[model samples]
Target: MAETATHSGTAVRVYDLHKSYREGAHALEVLHGVNLDIARGDLTLLMGPSGSGKTTLLTIMGLLMKPTSGRVELLGRDVTSLDESALPALRRRHVGFIFQNFNLLGALNAAENVEVVLGLQGVRGRAARKQAMALLDQVGLADRWSHLPDEMSGGEKQRVGVARALASQAELILADEPTGNLDSRTAAQVVDILRHLAHTENRAVLVVTHDLGLQEHADCVVRMRDGTIVEPHDGVAA
Candidate 1:
């Protein structure tokens, strides 16, 4: 990976990225010198078949895993060299992660679920509550603020997850198979919200998914095959 700094408008950049795992005495390479840039104000899609290393790349960019070799810059900061202990704080400030499963607190309502994130960022008391409500409203869930995860539909729960992600004020949003569990119509609704976030809010959103339907809403589409990007980021917004 190059040691160059990430550009101002870029949210995440990876250069010459490589990752490998030790299988007994052999090193099995997963990512082969992958290079990509996720720009601000764009919803990017990372699509690939199983074992193509999409989740590996996403986890590394999200600062949850270390690259075996390469450079990772997040929001213009060179995070590749940061200490492991420091990554969580940096990720909390700059990255919001959404998983395939709705990782919500079943006991907490939609607003409280989002409020928990604000609280972690030190915005507590009435301020956290107010901001959480505003975020829920942004995801068109204001009326469902009091609903728990079980009380909501799959799409509604995902919206709460989206609102919770936004509560952190994260500049980069990384989602893994966000629509994997929803029906076609519900998936479209969720993707529309994500597209709106990237365009209107100017946040960089990267979704790792197999759903080609999302391509219509993506600002950039990256394809991976056999652990390397076979398709370039051809559709990125200028």
Candidate 2:
């Protein structure tokens, strides 16, 4: 995959990031002195095998986990030291996430599931519902807005998850194996949506995956191995 054209603005910056967990008497480092910059409006793919720190890097970028050491700057704000109370607001406003499992509520309809995230961000009932419906429509799930998770196929559920991620109008999106559960055709569709979100909507997208087929849609690929970035090709880690 070719690197996305670098924009003048920086979307994310990491300085010497390090993360470790205590495994008995010794510390197991998951990420070792990592540094990266994600340009605004770029779609970057992170690829690696298990235990390669790809997911660790993604989670840190998404502010879902704090690094043991190092600095993270998101949209020019240093978030490494932010407290938990402030994190929720910051993450909700500036970052979005799409998990492989789709993570939708079994009891809620498509639109309702999207609305739940907006509601957490303080968007009221009617407004949240409207925005959720709009996002669902944008993701080609308008007709399925009333369908529950169990009533939908794997592809449909993933689409609903994508809609929910967009509900907050976040500038940065982190997707972890987003298409891992779908058929080839559906996976392609999902990848198209992600590319559209980054290039068309100007959102910075980082996707962590082991699937090489997604490389075609990525602007850059970053590949990691043994807790460190081993290769950076055209901005995709490979």
RMSD of each: 4.7, 2.4
Model 1 misplaced stretches (Cα beyond 4 Å): 1-8, 233-238
For model 1, give the RMSD to the true fold.
Answer: 4.7
lDDT of 1 by residue, 58-127 (tens): 9999999999999999987888998899998899999998877889999999989998989898999999
Per-residue lDDT tens digits of candidate 2, residues 97-191?
99899999999999899989888889978898889888998899889999999999998999998888888778888899988999877887887
For all candidates, the clash counts are 0, 9
Q: What is model 2's C-alpha RMSD?
A: 2.4
Which ranges of candidate 2 are over 4 A from the true structure? 2-8, 233-238
TM-score of each: 0.93, 0.91
lDDT of 1 at 134: 90
Q: 125, model 2: CA deviation in Å?
A: 3.2
